[model samples]
Target: MVKKKFRYDVGILFISAVVLFVTGLGISQGTPQKKNPPFEIDRFIPVETCADCHSEIYEQWENSMHSLSHTDPIYNRVAKFLRQGLIDNDEIEEAESCVKCHTPVGFVSGFPTRLSDDLTKTPEIATRGIQCDYCHSATSVTKMYNNGLVLKPGHGEDDPGIKRGPRDDAQPDFHDAQYSKLHTESGICGTCHNVKHVVFGTDLETTYTEWENSPYNSPDPEKRVTCQGCHMYQRPGIPATGSTERPKNPGAATDYSDERPHIYTHYFVGANVAVPAMFGDEEKSNMARERLKNAATIDVDIDPADKKQIHVTVSNTGAGHSIPTGLGNLRQVWVEIIARDRGGKTTYEKGVLDAGSELPEDAWMFRTVLGDGKGNPVINIAKAREVLSDTRIKAGEQMRQTFDMGFVPRKGTTITARLLYRGAPQKLLKQIPGEPIEPQPVVEMAKAVRTF
Candidate 1:
């Protein structure tokens, strides 16, 4: 709670400074200096500082994937393996590569630290993990070979040298206010959200690229939706509480089409509940769970007379990228179904990974497994040679699966069934496998359902 308050306080002051700078309202009368401010403008304004006056917004953000960008255990492990490869091959320095996104502030401050830097120890800096200032401070982006974010700290909001954001509320208790165009576009997010491999340049992570080619980004002018349209909206529960600036829908079509009177949310929520839970943030994990629940639909089907055939459908009603898109080799999504008879005996089961084990046998999860020239699965990132197979669910696509089983229903009764969807499947293993293992069969996506 103290962290939250401190973050908000920082956010308030930073935002005020930005607004005043951009609006040219708080410029001290003096000769224009040729050099930029001496403050470490490159450092990100940690999240906790934004929690002071914007407590609500801070809470929402603390629950988002953005807040956990550097702390996710799975990501941390994968990065370690990759970094070791870089170090052994003498390709890059140890802290230089990972700190780009994980500890932008530390990198900016010239502190050579590992991803293990405790944000709690440096509460202000920790809160800035992929934080408000880090993003808003970006002056321009040069998308060349890798995910390069050209930084001109204190550039946005007229060189405020403080926190920058999208808000229009009247808060005289804080710094000045100013509106910025960068805050409204997806380009700002593309800075870090998009990732590319330095060695192969094969585009390991390309959420922004996928969005650019998506129907949502139609350039036809008549049919198009910005990334913000889907991710941020008055979708019954996701507008920014601190922002007074509403969305301007030039093509207003409904009563809800009017300006929202506030900016979209900064939670930057996604379908990664397991990670936050692992980080000791139960509230954040729960929020991720709710967001995932609200993002899709599930259905189950089984013939009454013919109990052998069971069909399930999962629809990607939400999520702009391909379901289970990024870090495909690491991230996993699958559906588990269990059928029971009147006596509560299990008739059939699917998608169950043994406790504290790797992915279950024949689990129909969404992911991409890399392989070597020998046509075998390759787990070691350092040894990975090429792509093997990818079975991810596409946006707006419904995945269906049919299972044949022999479970007779009770006389004049139906069998009870339950279907579960999980985000990460191979989370238990501390290290990845060395050899190719038997991969699971892919069932189209599966939804939830019950029999009468």
Candidate 2:
């Protein structure tokens, strides 16, 4: 009995030591891992650094979706919810998931080293702020979706010498000029443009694929343009070098070359005018409004008889990529058609946000919703279980919807079609139903075609 008791004690001691050893290794493995100084908060290169030289590209990038990716109010609120949800459940590690995209530098630099603080608060790291350096420095992308990124900071085949981009006339003050082929490729955008559910493996978004497959991507001469073509191209009036904003273009091979040609415009403009409008940048907001107007065209077909079918055809005529490019699950783009009769009677209406959760009976919606773990519908991206459905129009893709109604417009009746870009669907706002949503500006893509 004495011998047996002694052996049992020895065994217990051995097991405890083994467990301690394993736990130590696990803790060490999870320790902060910092790779390069560029990622370091204090060592980060600011947007101002790049703007000083590449003003056009810098300005364009500053106003782009990437710049606003983190600072965006909607994104901020969603991220807060995600972080809180994980923390409330003691899933602290999982909370870092959003930092990978919204605050990439902080994640890479070990600032979030732990979840006790707002990672974006690091001044230098904040300055980097998803600027040109971070993107231009990306080595490769490991996965096509869900921010599956593989970054290598040091110089490589794709490095723009010391400074990278596509410009025969580009001059560099800080580093050697090397044009990275990757910069011009669609893959650059795919790093974030495509998204997938981490748990379900369901494709949440695929803007890259949509553009690659669409007729709009048929190359410039083919009249198919790229995302860069529309977003980066400069307006004829927005001069590259002027007394207002001096041109950053330094290298010159020809006299006919426009200053805008050398430097990509930094307007980084898009359809999300609401946020900027909220921030009181009415000028930029108006510009964004116009950009949306240029994004698509709508055609209406209606018969002036009772119980007529109204067909609305929407085409992605301007967007270089899909009309709704990123975060397809949250982006909603559709047409609101209204038909009136000579007596000032309402004949048909669609795409209006109804008080009920259901969409208008006759309106076709270009949006998606997901099912939660319980198989119930969910529009909050933070709570997505699986994608229920998606029908966002792709670039160069055309969709026609028919609405059958009892009332028919008489001669001289007015018909109006308004194209809209809602950042998030109503279902998403269901969480806080009473709160006001940042209203997405509606653009009049087309006017009346005259009644039959």
Candidate 3:
């Protein structure tokens, strides 16, 4: 009995040691973190260092989405959720992958991104997502999607860091600067803009793919308008493609530098307002609102043959990419149509947001629907098994919807159609954990009215 008891105790000790060994190796994050970090974290210069000389450009990028990529509250929660969920699914490596794009410095420098690691203590450089140093340090892009950026970080803090950009004549007093043709091309943006799920092989994002196939991607170099052309430049309205006239933004590239014809604006504005507003960036939120108001056009008319039929045409005339591009499953675009009788009484309405900002079932939504493998609709990107449907208006395309008015228009009847945009669906917002976010404000992109 004593011998048997001793053997049991020995077996328990062996199991405990094995657990401790695995834990020490950082096996919890699937692949062990780099045993020897590639470079010290200080090798990646903080954005504030560049801000000292390039204050204007730095302010433009301060509240921009790229700068908020890693620290966005919803993004952090979702990423953590993905990591937690994947651990149960036995696919922990996918959880560790966000660092590639969201926290490039941490990923390149191997500064532990494990869930168990305390992110609250993250270095300031790591918190400034997609900042100046990181982009300028990009050497090349070998792959097309899922953060394929190849980074060659600067030597060290004491050394003059090697930085690259589109300018050939750049001469900075503090660091080594070289001209890189890749910085001027769209392929570099494609590296991170296009995303395919690592394990599932699902096409998660198609921002690059949409632009690649659009007419704006012309064969002639002078006629091609890359993602940077529109997104990185300031314009109240868009489609600043090579096909259209884009006003040059005159500004000094840096202190004591020549005033340039155009230095690309760095707000990187698209259709995001709520996220920026949540973080108290009203300027960015207003810029987003202005951009959305100018993004599309609409026309409404009663059919000539069928007096009761109303035709509403919506055109993606202003954007170089598809309307509602990026994170297809979350972004929502739809048309709200309304008809009023002569007495100012509401006769018919569709796509109206309820008190809670929820869209009615009949709303004509322009979005992608992803499904779990078994044909069940899934909201979380991690659970997306397949794309069930995509109803977004393609770049440079038009969509016309005809509605049966159910009655003839009276002499004073009015018909209206408004194209609207929301950052994310209401249902998905409710599902996100932690403090509930305020409902995203609805922005009317375009509207047309006809009175008989």
Best by TM-score: 3
Lowest summed-lDDT stretch of 10 residues in model 2? 238-247
Give the per-residue lDDT of model 3 (tens digit) for 292-330.
776788999998888899988888877778888888878
Tell me, by lDDT, which candidate is best: 3
Tens-digit lDDT track for model 1 on 1-452? 43663564466447434533532432321111123332353344445544655565566566467776666656665665554544432123222356556665555554424444444454346434676666656554444212345555553333345334465442323334445555665656665665543332234556776666566555454545555665555222442111112243232211232343444555565555566666677765554455555445677777666877777777666656666766676666777777765666766777765765455768766677776447897654444545677776666567888777665555433333333344444442444445422222222223454654
- Candidate 2 residue runs with Cα over 4 Å from true position: 1-39, 82-96, 113-117, 148-161, 168-171, 216-224, 234-261, 304-307, 354-362, 373-375, 408-411, 430-438, 445-449
Instruction: Pick out the ten consecutive residues of candidate 3 with the lowest summed lDDT.
Output: 28-37
Q: Can you give the lDDT of residue 257 in candidate 1?
A: 29
- Greater lDDT among 2 and 3 belongs to 3
Name the 10 consecutive residues with the lowest summed lDDT in model 1: 26-35
TM-score between model 3 and native: 0.87
lDDT-wise, the better of 1 and 2 is 2
Superposition TM-score, candidate 1 onto the true structure: 0.68
Model 3, C-alpha of 26: deviation from truth (Å) = 19
| lDDT agreement of model 1 with the native | 0.52
Rank order (by lDDT, best first): 3, 2, 1
